[model samples]
Target: MSGAIEFWFDFSSSYAYFAAKRIDALGARVGRPVLWRPFMLGTAFRETGARGLSTTPLKKDYARHDWARLARAGGFDFRLPEGHPLIALAATRAFYAIDEDSPAEAARFARAVFERYYIEGLDTTSARAMGDFAAGLGLDGDRIAAACESAAIKDKARVMSESAVARGVFGSPWFFVDDEPFWGHDRMAMMEDWIRTGGW
Candidate 1:
Protein backbone atom coordinates (compact mmCIF):
# COMPACT_ATOMS: atom_id res chain seq x y z
CA MET A 1 0.00 0.00 0.00
CA SER A 2 2.93 2.29 0.51
CA GLY A 3 4.25 1.73 -3.01
CA ALA A 4 2.81 0.98 -6.41
CA ILE A 5 2.81 -2.43 -8.03
CA GLU A 6 4.39 -2.16 -11.48
CA PHE A 7 2.55 -4.44 -13.88
CA TRP A 8 4.35 -5.19 -17.12
CA PHE A 9 2.31 -6.84 -19.83
CA ASP A 10 2.19 -7.36 -23.57
CA PHE A 11 -1.07 -6.91 -25.40
CA SER A 12 -0.41 -10.03 -27.44
CA SER A 13 -0.16 -12.23 -24.33
CA SER A 14 -3.25 -14.14 -23.22
CA TYR A 15 -1.93 -14.44 -19.69
CA ALA A 16 -1.55 -10.70 -19.59
CA TYR A 17 -5.23 -10.42 -20.50
CA PHE A 18 -6.01 -12.76 -17.66
CA ALA A 19 -4.08 -10.67 -15.17
CA ALA A 20 -5.56 -7.41 -16.43
CA LYS A 21 -9.07 -8.52 -15.61
CA ARG A 22 -8.30 -8.84 -11.92
CA ILE A 23 -5.30 -6.68 -11.04
CA ASP A 24 -7.28 -3.51 -10.39
CA ALA A 25 -9.56 -5.03 -7.81
CA LEU A 26 -6.64 -6.71 -6.10
CA GLY A 27 -4.75 -3.42 -5.88
CA ALA A 28 -7.83 -1.67 -4.55
CA ARG A 29 -8.23 -4.30 -1.87
CA VAL A 30 -4.67 -3.78 -0.72
CA GLY A 31 -4.85 0.02 -0.90
CA ARG A 32 -2.15 0.08 -3.58
CA PRO A 33 -2.18 1.71 -6.97
CA VAL A 34 -1.27 -0.44 -9.97
CA LEU A 35 0.94 1.00 -12.65
CA TRP A 36 -0.05 -0.71 -15.87
CA ARG A 37 2.78 -0.89 -18.35
CA PRO A 38 2.07 -2.25 -21.82
CA PHE A 39 5.26 -3.15 -23.66
CA MET A 40 6.23 -5.23 -26.70
CA LEU A 41 7.07 -8.85 -25.88
CA GLY A 42 8.88 -9.13 -29.20
CA THR A 43 11.59 -6.85 -27.89
CA ALA A 44 12.25 -9.03 -24.88
CA PHE A 45 12.02 -12.15 -27.01
CA ARG A 46 14.77 -10.83 -29.24
CA GLU A 47 16.91 -10.11 -26.23
CA THR A 48 16.37 -13.59 -24.75
CA GLY A 49 16.56 -15.51 -28.06
CA ALA A 50 13.10 -16.98 -27.51
CA ARG A 51 9.81 -17.27 -29.33
CA GLY A 52 6.34 -17.02 -27.83
CA LEU A 53 4.86 -20.14 -26.28
CA SER A 54 2.16 -20.23 -28.93
CA THR A 55 4.88 -20.40 -31.55
CA THR A 56 6.40 -23.55 -30.14
CA PRO A 57 4.91 -26.81 -31.43
CA LEU A 58 4.25 -29.03 -28.41
CA LYS A 59 4.32 -26.13 -26.00
CA LYS A 60 1.74 -24.34 -28.12
CA ASP A 61 -0.70 -27.24 -27.84
CA TYR A 62 -0.21 -27.44 -24.10
CA ALA A 63 -0.63 -23.69 -23.69
CA ARG A 64 -4.05 -23.78 -25.32
CA HIS A 65 -5.24 -26.52 -23.03
CA ASP A 66 -3.72 -24.87 -19.98
CA TRP A 67 -5.30 -21.53 -20.78
CA ALA A 68 -8.67 -23.20 -21.13
CA ARG A 69 -8.19 -25.08 -17.87
CA LEU A 70 -7.26 -21.92 -16.05
CA ALA A 71 -10.33 -20.20 -17.47
CA ARG A 72 -12.57 -23.01 -16.32
CA ALA A 73 -11.01 -22.99 -12.87
CA GLY A 74 -11.58 -19.26 -12.65
CA GLY A 75 -15.11 -19.56 -14.05
CA PHE A 76 -14.44 -17.28 -17.01
CA ASP A 77 -15.02 -17.84 -20.70
CA PHE A 78 -11.94 -18.13 -22.93
CA ARG A 79 -11.82 -19.06 -26.57
CA LEU A 80 -8.67 -19.16 -28.60
CA PRO A 81 -8.94 -17.02 -31.69
CA GLU A 82 -8.54 -18.61 -35.12
CA GLY A 83 -4.92 -17.45 -34.87
CA HIS A 84 -3.32 -17.15 -31.48
CA PRO A 85 -0.52 -14.77 -30.50
CA LEU A 86 -1.79 -11.75 -32.39
CA ILE A 87 0.46 -8.87 -33.37
CA ALA A 88 -0.60 -6.12 -30.99
CA LEU A 89 1.63 -3.16 -31.76
CA ALA A 90 -1.30 -0.91 -32.58
CA ALA A 91 -3.11 -1.68 -29.36
CA THR A 92 0.02 -1.25 -27.27
CA ARG A 93 0.80 2.06 -28.95
CA ALA A 94 -2.74 3.29 -28.46
CA PHE A 95 -2.56 2.52 -24.73
CA TYR A 96 0.72 4.37 -24.42
CA ALA A 97 -0.77 7.37 -26.21
CA ILE A 98 -3.54 7.52 -23.64
CA ASP A 99 -1.17 6.57 -20.80
CA GLU A 100 1.02 9.57 -21.37
CA ASP A 101 -1.86 11.74 -20.22
CA SER A 102 -3.85 9.47 -17.93
CA PRO A 103 -2.73 6.15 -16.48
CA ALA A 104 -6.13 5.28 -14.97
CA GLU A 105 -7.92 6.00 -18.22
CA ALA A 106 -5.31 3.96 -20.10
CA ALA A 107 -6.02 1.02 -17.81
CA ARG A 108 -9.70 1.20 -18.75
CA PHE A 109 -8.79 1.36 -22.42
CA ALA A 110 -6.49 -1.64 -21.96
CA ARG A 111 -9.31 -3.70 -20.47
CA ALA A 112 -11.46 -2.93 -23.51
CA VAL A 113 -8.63 -3.87 -25.87
CA PHE A 114 -7.96 -7.12 -23.95
CA GLU A 115 -11.62 -8.10 -24.14
CA ARG A 116 -11.74 -7.26 -27.82
CA TYR A 117 -8.77 -9.43 -28.65
CA TYR A 118 -9.18 -12.28 -26.16
CA ILE A 119 -12.98 -12.52 -25.86
CA GLU A 120 -14.61 -10.99 -28.89
CA GLY A 121 -11.77 -12.18 -31.16
CA LEU A 122 -11.39 -8.79 -32.74
CA ASP A 123 -8.22 -7.47 -34.32
CA THR A 124 -6.12 -5.55 -31.85
CA THR A 125 -3.25 -4.94 -34.24
CA SER A 126 -5.03 -2.74 -36.73
CA ALA A 127 -5.09 1.04 -36.43
CA ARG A 128 -8.80 1.07 -37.15
CA ALA A 129 -9.58 -1.37 -34.40
CA MET A 130 -7.48 0.52 -31.89
CA GLY A 131 -9.07 3.81 -32.91
CA ASP A 132 -12.54 2.38 -32.55
CA PHE A 133 -11.71 1.03 -29.09
CA ALA A 134 -10.30 4.38 -28.00
CA ALA A 135 -13.33 6.21 -29.29
CA GLY A 136 -15.55 3.91 -27.31
CA LEU A 137 -13.66 5.11 -24.21
CA GLY A 138 -14.61 8.70 -25.12
CA LEU A 139 -11.17 9.53 -26.41
CA ASP A 140 -10.54 11.18 -29.78
CA GLY A 141 -10.12 8.17 -32.04
CA ASP A 142 -8.42 10.06 -34.86
CA ARG A 143 -5.93 11.61 -32.49
CA ILE A 144 -5.22 8.28 -30.86
CA ALA A 145 -4.61 6.75 -34.28
CA ALA A 146 -2.33 9.61 -35.26
CA ALA A 147 -0.37 9.36 -32.02
CA CYS A 148 0.38 5.72 -32.67
CA GLU A 149 2.36 6.80 -35.69
CA SER A 150 4.01 9.80 -34.11
CA ALA A 151 7.72 9.56 -33.47
CA ALA A 152 7.32 10.74 -29.88
CA ILE A 153 4.80 8.08 -29.06
CA LYS A 154 6.80 5.42 -30.87
CA ASP A 155 9.93 6.46 -28.99
CA LYS A 156 8.09 6.39 -25.71
CA ALA A 157 6.97 2.85 -26.35
CA ARG A 158 10.46 1.83 -27.41
CA VAL A 159 11.96 3.29 -24.27
CA MET A 160 9.43 1.48 -22.09
CA SER A 161 10.18 -1.86 -23.74
CA GLU A 162 13.91 -1.33 -23.36
CA SER A 163 13.51 -0.28 -19.77
CA ALA A 164 11.50 -3.38 -19.02
CA VAL A 165 14.18 -5.61 -20.50
CA ALA A 166 16.90 -3.75 -18.68
CA ARG A 167 15.00 -4.21 -15.47
CA GLY A 168 14.98 -8.02 -16.00
CA VAL A 169 11.46 -8.47 -17.29
CA PHE A 170 11.65 -11.59 -19.42
CA GLY A 171 7.96 -12.25 -19.90
CA SER A 172 4.48 -10.82 -19.95
CA PRO A 173 2.26 -10.59 -16.86
CA TRP A 174 5.26 -9.61 -14.75
CA PHE A 175 4.84 -7.51 -11.65
CA PHE A 176 7.29 -5.50 -9.56
CA VAL A 177 6.48 -4.64 -6.02
CA ASP A 178 9.30 -2.16 -5.66
CA ASP A 179 12.40 -4.17 -6.71
CA GLU A 180 10.83 -7.60 -6.18
CA PRO A 181 9.74 -9.18 -9.46
CA PHE A 182 7.04 -11.81 -9.99
CA TRP A 183 6.08 -13.41 -13.29
CA GLY A 184 3.01 -15.14 -14.75
CA HIS A 185 -0.71 -14.81 -14.11
CA ASP A 186 -0.48 -17.77 -11.74
CA ARG A 187 1.71 -15.65 -9.46
CA MET A 188 -1.04 -13.16 -8.68
CA ALA A 189 -1.83 -14.69 -5.32
CA MET A 190 1.82 -14.49 -4.35
CA MET A 191 1.91 -10.92 -5.58
CA GLU A 192 -1.05 -10.06 -3.41
CA ASP A 193 0.67 -11.71 -0.49
CA TRP A 194 3.80 -9.71 -1.16
CA ILE A 195 1.75 -6.55 -1.28
CA ARG A 196 0.02 -7.35 1.98
CA THR A 197 2.97 -8.70 3.95
CA GLY A 198 5.76 -6.78 2.23
CA GLY A 199 7.41 -10.01 1.07
CA TRP A 200 8.87 -12.80 3.24
Candidate 2:
Protein backbone atom coordinates (compact mmCIF):
# COMPACT_ATOMS: atom_id res chain seq x y z
CA MET A 1 0.00 0.00 0.00
CA SER A 2 1.12 3.57 -0.57
CA GLY A 3 2.23 5.55 2.46
CA ALA A 4 -0.70 7.09 4.33
CA ILE A 5 -1.11 10.83 4.41
CA GLU A 6 -0.42 11.93 7.97
CA PHE A 7 -3.05 14.53 8.83
CA TRP A 8 -2.13 16.24 12.09
CA PHE A 9 -4.84 18.50 13.41
CA ASP A 10 -6.38 19.97 16.55
CA PHE A 11 -10.06 19.70 17.29
CA SER A 12 -10.35 23.34 18.23
CA SER A 13 -8.90 24.63 15.01
CA SER A 14 -11.36 26.09 12.51
CA TYR A 15 -8.97 25.60 9.64
CA ALA A 16 -8.44 22.03 10.71
CA TYR A 17 -12.22 21.58 10.54
CA PHE A 18 -12.04 22.61 6.91
CA ALA A 19 -9.22 20.22 6.18
CA ALA A 20 -11.08 17.34 7.79
CA LYS A 21 -13.95 17.78 5.35
CA ARG A 22 -11.69 17.48 2.32
CA ILE A 23 -8.70 15.32 3.27
CA ASP A 24 -10.23 11.88 3.01
CA ALA A 25 -11.38 12.47 -0.59
CA LEU A 26 -7.95 13.79 -1.46
CA GLY A 27 -6.43 10.56 -0.19
CA ALA A 28 -8.92 8.48 -2.17
CA ARG A 29 -8.11 10.35 -5.36
CA VAL A 30 -4.43 9.55 -4.97
CA GLY A 31 -4.81 5.93 -3.86
CA ARG A 32 -3.41 6.73 -0.45
CA PRO A 33 -5.07 6.38 2.93
CA VAL A 34 -5.49 9.34 5.24
CA LEU A 35 -4.28 8.93 8.80
CA TRP A 36 -6.11 11.39 10.99
CA ARG A 37 -3.98 12.26 13.98
CA PRO A 38 -5.52 14.61 16.54
CA PHE A 39 -2.98 16.26 18.81
CA MET A 40 -3.19 19.04 21.39
CA LEU A 41 -2.48 22.35 19.69
CA GLY A 42 -1.78 23.81 23.13
CA THR A 43 1.40 21.77 23.33
CA ALA A 44 2.56 23.19 20.04
CA PHE A 45 1.73 26.70 21.24
CA ARG A 46 3.72 26.20 24.41
CA GLU A 47 6.71 24.97 22.46
CA THR A 48 6.56 27.62 19.74
CA GLY A 49 5.29 30.54 21.89
CA ALA A 50 2.54 31.15 19.38
CA ARG A 51 -1.04 32.12 20.10
CA GLY A 52 -4.01 30.53 18.37
CA LEU A 53 -5.52 32.22 15.35
CA SER A 54 -8.64 33.02 17.34
CA THR A 55 -6.60 34.47 20.15
CA THR A 56 -4.08 36.37 18.08
CA PRO A 57 -4.59 40.13 17.60
CA LEU A 58 -5.36 41.35 14.10
CA LYS A 59 -5.09 37.87 12.72
CA LYS A 60 -8.14 36.74 14.63
CA ASP A 61 -10.39 39.16 12.77
CA TYR A 62 -8.84 38.23 9.46
CA ALA A 63 -9.28 34.58 10.27
CA ARG A 64 -12.98 35.00 10.97
CA HIS A 65 -13.52 36.62 7.60
CA ASP A 66 -11.38 34.08 5.86
CA TRP A 67 -13.24 31.24 7.48
CA ALA A 68 -16.57 32.56 6.21
CA ARG A 69 -15.15 32.99 2.74
CA LEU A 70 -13.72 29.51 2.81
CA ALA A 71 -17.08 28.16 3.94
CA ARG A 72 -18.93 29.91 1.13
CA ALA A 73 -16.45 28.69 -1.44
CA GLY A 74 -16.55 25.15 -0.11
CA GLY A 75 -20.33 25.15 0.33
CA PHE A 76 -20.14 24.07 3.94
CA ASP A 77 -21.86 25.54 6.95
CA PHE A 78 -19.49 27.08 9.48
CA ARG A 79 -19.79 29.20 12.55
CA LEU A 80 -17.43 29.75 15.46
CA PRO A 81 -18.49 28.01 18.60
CA GLU A 82 -19.62 30.12 21.58
CA GLY A 83 -16.22 29.96 23.17
CA HIS A 84 -13.60 29.90 20.49
CA PRO A 85 -10.41 27.93 21.05
CA LEU A 86 -11.89 25.28 23.31
CA ILE A 87 -9.74 22.96 25.35
CA ALA A 88 -9.72 19.79 23.29
CA LEU A 89 -7.84 17.48 25.66
CA ALA A 90 -10.87 15.32 26.37
CA ALA A 91 -11.80 14.98 22.72
CA THR A 92 -8.24 14.13 21.71
CA ARG A 93 -7.92 11.48 24.40
CA ALA A 94 -11.24 9.97 23.48
CA PHE A 95 -10.22 9.87 19.82
CA TYR A 96 -7.03 7.92 20.50
CA ALA A 97 -8.85 5.50 22.76
CA ILE A 98 -11.51 4.83 20.14
CA ASP A 99 -8.93 4.71 17.35
CA GLU A 100 -7.17 1.83 19.05
CA ASP A 101 -10.24 -0.31 18.47
CA SER A 102 -11.70 1.00 15.21
CA PRO A 103 -9.99 3.59 13.03
CA ALA A 104 -12.98 4.16 10.76
CA GLU A 105 -15.32 4.77 13.65
CA ALA A 106 -12.82 7.06 15.26
CA ALA A 107 -12.60 9.10 12.08
CA ARG A 108 -16.37 9.33 11.95
CA PHE A 109 -16.45 10.37 15.58
CA ALA A 110 -13.86 13.01 14.87
CA ARG A 111 -15.98 14.44 12.10
CA ALA A 112 -19.03 14.46 14.32
CA VAL A 113 -17.15 16.24 17.05
CA PHE A 114 -15.95 18.84 14.57
CA GLU A 115 -19.49 19.31 13.27
CA ARG A 116 -20.87 19.67 16.77
CA TYR A 117 -18.51 22.47 17.51
CA TYR A 118 -18.10 24.23 14.16
CA ILE A 119 -21.53 23.68 12.70
CA GLU A 120 -23.87 23.30 15.60
CA GLY A 121 -22.05 25.77 17.84
CA LEU A 122 -22.03 23.31 20.68
CA ASP A 123 -19.49 22.63 23.41
CA THR A 124 -17.35 19.59 22.72
CA THR A 125 -14.58 20.25 25.19
CA SER A 126 -15.76 18.01 27.97
CA ALA A 127 -15.80 14.27 28.50
CA ARG A 128 -19.57 14.37 28.71
CA ALA A 129 -19.78 15.89 25.27
CA MET A 130 -17.45 13.25 23.92
CA GLY A 131 -19.61 10.57 25.44
CA ASP A 132 -22.75 12.04 23.96
CA PHE A 133 -21.22 12.16 20.53
CA ALA A 134 -19.92 8.62 20.82
CA ALA A 135 -23.30 7.38 21.99
CA GLY A 136 -24.96 9.05 19.06
CA LEU A 137 -22.72 7.00 16.82
CA GLY A 138 -23.79 3.77 18.54
CA LEU A 139 -20.51 3.35 20.43
CA ASP A 140 -20.17 2.71 24.13
CA GLY A 141 -20.15 6.30 25.26
CA ASP A 142 -19.78 5.63 28.96
CA ARG A 143 -16.77 3.42 28.39
CA ILE A 144 -15.27 5.95 26.03
CA ALA A 145 -15.69 8.70 28.60
CA ALA A 146 -14.12 6.57 31.28
CA ALA A 147 -11.25 5.79 28.97
CA CYS A 148 -10.57 9.47 28.54
CA GLU A 149 -9.57 9.68 32.19
CA SER A 150 -7.43 6.58 32.10
CA ALA A 151 -3.72 7.10 32.64
CA ALA A 152 -2.93 5.06 29.56
CA ILE A 153 -5.04 7.23 27.27
CA LYS A 154 -3.80 10.43 28.86
CA ASP A 155 -0.24 9.35 28.37
CA LYS A 156 -0.96 8.33 24.80
CA ALA A 157 -2.41 11.74 23.99
CA ARG A 158 0.54 13.54 25.60
CA VAL A 159 3.04 11.41 23.77
CA MET A 160 1.26 12.01 20.47
CA SER A 161 1.42 15.76 20.98
CA GLU A 162 5.09 15.55 21.81
CA SER A 163 5.72 13.37 18.81
CA ALA A 164 3.96 15.89 16.58
CA VAL A 165 6.27 18.63 17.81
CA ALA A 166 9.25 16.36 17.35
CA ARG A 167 8.11 15.78 13.78
CA GLY A 168 8.15 19.58 13.16
CA VAL A 169 4.37 20.00 13.29
CA PHE A 170 3.47 23.43 14.67
CA GLY A 171 0.00 23.97 13.37
CA SER A 172 -3.31 22.27 12.82
CA PRO A 173 -4.01 20.74 9.36
CA TRP A 174 -0.35 19.92 8.99
CA PHE A 175 0.39 17.19 6.49
CA PHE A 176 3.32 14.97 5.61
CA VAL A 177 3.76 13.58 2.13
CA ASP A 178 6.62 11.22 2.83
CA ASP A 179 9.17 13.24 4.88
CA GLU A 180 8.15 16.64 3.55
CA PRO A 181 5.99 18.81 5.85
CA PHE A 182 3.17 21.06 4.70
CA TRP A 183 1.34 23.29 7.15
CA GLY A 184 -2.08 25.00 6.91
CA HIS A 185 -5.28 24.11 5.05
CA ASP A 186 -4.36 26.39 2.14
CA ARG A 187 -1.42 24.11 1.39
CA MET A 188 -3.70 21.25 0.41
CA ALA A 189 -3.45 22.19 -3.27
CA MET A 190 0.32 22.12 -3.11
CA MET A 191 0.07 18.80 -1.29
CA GLU A 192 -2.09 17.38 -4.09
CA ASP A 193 0.39 18.56 -6.66
CA TRP A 194 3.25 16.98 -4.74
CA ILE A 195 1.36 13.72 -4.47
CA ARG A 196 0.52 13.72 -8.19
CA THR A 197 4.03 14.60 -9.38
CA GLY A 198 6.06 12.75 -6.73
CA GLY A 199 7.63 15.99 -5.52
CA TRP A 200 9.63 18.60 -7.47
Candidate 3:
Protein backbone atom coordinates (compact mmCIF):
# COMPACT_ATOMS: atom_id res chain seq x y z
CA MET A 1 0.00 0.00 0.00
CA SER A 2 1.13 3.57 -0.63
CA GLY A 3 2.19 5.58 2.38
CA ALA A 4 0.02 8.47 3.43
CA ILE A 5 1.19 12.06 3.64
CA GLU A 6 2.14 12.56 7.27
CA PHE A 7 1.37 16.09 8.43
CA TRP A 8 3.10 16.67 11.76
CA PHE A 9 2.25 20.01 13.28
CA ASP A 10 1.65 21.96 16.44
CA PHE A 11 -1.87 23.05 17.13
CA SER A 12 -0.74 26.51 18.22
CA SER A 13 1.36 27.26 15.16
CA SER A 14 0.03 29.88 12.75
CA TYR A 15 2.06 28.47 9.91
CA ALA A 16 0.61 25.05 10.62
CA TYR A 17 -2.83 26.65 10.65
CA PHE A 18 -2.23 27.95 7.14
CA ALA A 19 -0.95 24.58 6.01
CA ALA A 20 -3.88 22.79 7.61
CA LYS A 21 -6.24 24.85 5.48
CA ARG A 22 -4.75 23.45 2.28
CA ILE A 23 -3.12 20.10 3.10
CA ASP A 24 -6.20 17.94 2.58
CA ALA A 25 -6.68 19.35 -0.88
CA LEU A 26 -3.05 18.78 -1.67
CA GLY A 27 -3.42 15.15 -0.60
CA ALA A 28 -6.51 14.83 -2.76
CA ARG A 29 -4.75 16.16 -5.84
CA VAL A 30 -1.91 13.71 -5.36
CA GLY A 31 -4.20 10.72 -4.75
CA ARG A 32 -2.92 10.25 -1.23
CA PRO A 33 -4.60 10.51 2.13
CA VAL A 34 -3.48 13.06 4.71
CA LEU A 35 -2.56 11.82 8.15
CA TRP A 36 -3.05 14.78 10.43
CA ARG A 37 -0.70 14.28 13.35
CA PRO A 38 -0.84 16.88 16.10
CA PHE A 39 2.15 17.17 18.37
CA MET A 40 3.42 19.60 21.01
CA LEU A 41 5.66 22.31 19.60
CA GLY A 42 6.99 23.08 23.06
CA THR A 43 8.58 19.65 23.13
CA ALA A 44 10.24 20.32 19.80
CA PHE A 45 11.39 23.76 20.97
CA ARG A 46 12.85 22.22 24.08
CA GLU A 47 14.76 19.65 22.05
CA THR A 48 15.96 22.11 19.41
CA GLY A 49 16.50 25.04 21.83
CA ALA A 50 14.44 27.24 19.56
CA ARG A 51 12.05 29.98 20.53
CA GLY A 52 8.61 30.51 19.11
CA LEU A 53 8.17 33.21 16.49
CA SER A 54 6.03 35.26 18.86
CA THR A 55 8.70 35.03 21.55
CA THR A 56 11.62 35.84 19.30
CA PRO A 57 12.31 39.61 19.09
CA LEU A 58 12.59 40.66 15.44
CA LYS A 59 11.02 37.58 13.92
CA LYS A 60 7.84 38.05 15.93
CA ASP A 61 6.89 41.29 14.19
CA TYR A 62 7.87 39.98 10.79
CA ALA A 63 5.94 36.78 11.38
CA ARG A 64 2.84 38.76 12.32
CA HIS A 65 3.10 40.76 9.12
CA ASP A 66 3.73 37.64 7.09
CA TRP A 67 0.71 35.96 8.62
CA ALA A 68 -1.49 38.89 7.67
CA ARG A 69 -0.16 38.88 4.13
CA LEU A 70 -0.63 35.12 3.81
CA ALA A 71 -4.17 35.38 5.13
CA ARG A 72 -5.01 38.09 2.62
CA ALA A 73 -3.38 36.20 -0.20
CA GLY A 74 -5.05 32.94 0.75
CA GLY A 75 -8.41 34.62 1.35
CA PHE A 76 -8.86 33.30 4.86
CA ASP A 77 -9.65 34.97 8.15
CA PHE A 78 -6.80 35.13 10.68
CA ARG A 79 -6.20 37.04 13.87
CA LEU A 80 -3.65 36.44 16.58
CA PRO A 81 -5.38 35.55 19.79
CA GLU A 82 -4.84 37.64 22.96
CA GLY A 83 -2.53 35.04 24.41
CA HIS A 84 -0.63 34.11 21.33
CA PRO A 85 1.11 30.73 21.33
CA LEU A 86 -1.03 29.34 24.06
CA ILE A 87 -0.40 25.77 25.28
CA ALA A 88 -2.01 23.22 22.97
CA LEU A 89 -1.55 20.13 25.15
CA ALA A 90 -5.22 19.71 25.89
CA ALA A 91 -6.26 19.95 22.30
CA THR A 92 -3.51 17.64 21.10
CA ARG A 93 -4.43 14.94 23.58
CA ALA A 94 -8.08 15.29 22.72
CA PHE A 95 -7.22 14.81 19.07
CA TYR A 96 -5.39 11.56 19.75
CA ALA A 97 -8.26 10.26 21.82
CA ILE A 98 -10.75 11.02 19.09
CA ASP A 99 -8.41 9.66 16.44
CA GLU A 100 -8.36 6.31 18.17
CA ASP A 101 -11.94 5.91 17.08
CA SER A 102 -12.27 8.11 14.02
CA PRO A 103 -9.38 9.69 12.13
CA ALA A 104 -11.57 11.75 9.81
CA GLU A 105 -13.46 13.12 12.79
CA ALA A 106 -10.20 13.88 14.52
CA ALA A 107 -9.03 15.86 11.50
CA ARG A 108 -12.30 17.71 11.51
CA PHE A 109 -11.85 18.44 15.20
CA ALA A 110 -8.32 19.71 14.63
CA ARG A 111 -9.48 22.08 11.90
CA ALA A 112 -12.21 23.42 14.15
CA VAL A 113 -9.71 23.97 16.92
CA PHE A 114 -7.44 25.86 14.54
CA GLU A 115 -10.32 28.01 13.31
CA ARG A 116 -11.38 28.79 16.87
CA TYR A 117 -7.91 29.96 17.82
CA TYR A 118 -6.65 31.65 14.67
CA ILE A 119 -9.81 32.86 12.95
CA GLU A 120 -12.24 33.40 15.79
CA GLY A 121 -9.54 34.77 18.12
CA LEU A 122 -10.62 32.45 20.91
CA ASP A 123 -8.86 30.29 23.47
CA THR A 124 -8.47 26.56 22.77
CA THR A 125 -5.70 25.81 25.21
CA SER A 126 -7.93 24.56 27.98
CA ALA A 127 -9.71 21.22 28.20
CA ARG A 128 -13.01 23.03 28.48
CA ALA A 129 -12.29 24.85 25.26
CA MET A 130 -11.33 21.61 23.56
CA GLY A 131 -14.58 20.05 24.71
CA ASP A 132 -16.52 22.97 23.35
CA PHE A 133 -14.85 22.63 19.99
CA ALA A 134 -15.52 18.88 19.92
CA ALA A 135 -19.14 19.42 20.93
CA GLY A 136 -19.54 21.87 18.13
CA LEU A 137 -18.62 19.05 15.78
CA GLY A 138 -21.25 16.68 17.18
CA LEU A 139 -18.74 14.75 19.23
CA ASP A 140 -18.77 13.74 22.87
CA GLY A 141 -17.31 16.91 24.37
CA ASP A 142 -17.14 15.67 27.93
CA ARG A 143 -15.53 12.39 26.93
CA ILE A 144 -12.97 14.16 24.83
CA ALA A 145 -12.21 16.70 27.55
CA ALA A 146 -11.89 13.91 30.10
CA ALA A 147 -9.59 12.02 27.76
CA CYS A 148 -7.18 14.93 27.92
CA GLU A 149 -6.31 13.80 31.42
CA SER A 150 -6.06 10.11 30.66
CA ALA A 151 -2.71 8.41 31.02
CA ALA A 152 -3.15 6.59 27.72
CA ILE A 153 -3.84 9.78 25.83
CA LYS A 154 -1.00 11.62 27.55
CA ASP A 155 1.43 8.85 26.64
CA LYS A 156 0.15 8.80 23.08
CA ALA A 157 0.69 12.53 22.72
CA ARG A 158 4.16 12.35 24.28
CA VAL A 159 5.19 9.49 22.06
CA MET A 160 3.90 11.26 18.99
CA SER A 161 5.96 14.35 19.79
CA GLU A 162 9.04 12.32 20.50
CA SER A 163 8.57 10.34 17.30
CA ALA A 164 8.21 13.55 15.32
CA VAL A 165 11.45 14.93 16.77
CA ALA A 166 13.23 11.66 16.13
CA ARG A 167 12.05 11.85 12.53
CA GLY A 168 13.77 15.30 12.15
CA VAL A 169 10.66 17.41 12.50
CA PHE A 170 11.91 20.63 14.07
CA GLY A 171 9.21 23.00 12.96
CA SER A 172 5.47 23.23 12.57
CA PRO A 173 3.74 22.21 9.33
CA TRP A 174 6.32 19.53 8.70
CA PHE A 175 5.40 16.97 6.06
CA PHE A 176 6.81 13.60 5.14
CA VAL A 177 6.01 12.21 1.72
CA ASP A 178 7.29 8.71 2.34
CA ASP A 179 10.86 9.10 3.72
CA GLU A 180 11.46 12.62 2.32
CA PRO A 181 10.82 15.51 4.69
CA PHE A 182 9.51 19.01 4.02
CA TRP A 183 9.40 21.86 6.50
CA GLY A 184 7.44 25.10 6.72
CA HIS A 185 4.24 26.16 4.97
CA ASP A 186 6.16 27.64 2.06
CA ARG A 187 7.64 24.23 1.28
CA MET A 188 4.23 22.80 0.41
CA ALA A 189 4.57 23.75 -3.24
CA MET A 190 7.97 22.06 -3.43
CA MET A 191 6.53 19.05 -1.66
CA GLU A 192 3.70 18.89 -4.16
CA ASP A 193 6.19 18.95 -7.03
CA TRP A 194 8.26 16.24 -5.42
CA ILE A 195 5.19 14.09 -5.03
CA ARG A 196 4.06 14.79 -8.60
CA THR A 197 7.41 13.89 -10.16
CA GLY A 198 8.13 11.09 -7.67
CA GLY A 199 11.15 13.11 -6.46
CA TRP A 200 14.03 14.43 -8.55
**Candidate 2 global CA lDDT score:** 0.91
Q: Whole-model Cα lDDT per candidate? A: 0.87, 0.91, 0.91
Instruction: List clashing residue pairs in candidate 2.
Output: none
lDDT of 3: 0.91
lDDT of 2 by residue, 120-175 (tens): 87666778778878988899999999999899999999999999999999999899
Writing each residue's lDDT as its tens digit, candidate 3 over 1-200 gives: 26799999998899999999999999999899999999988888999899999999999999999999999999999998888888888989999989999999999988888888896765667777788778888999999989988899999999999999988999998999988999999999999999999999
Candidate 1 residue-wise lDDT, 47-116, digit = tens:
9999999998998889888888888887877776767788888888898999888888898898888877
User: What is the C-alpha RMSD, rounded to one decimal, of candidate 2?
Assistant: 1.1
- Candidate 3 Cα misplacement greater than 4 A, ranges: none
**Which residue pairs show collisions in model 1?**
none
Which of candidates 1 and 3 reaches a greater lDDT?
A: 3
| Each model's Cα RMSD | 1.5, 1.1, 1.1
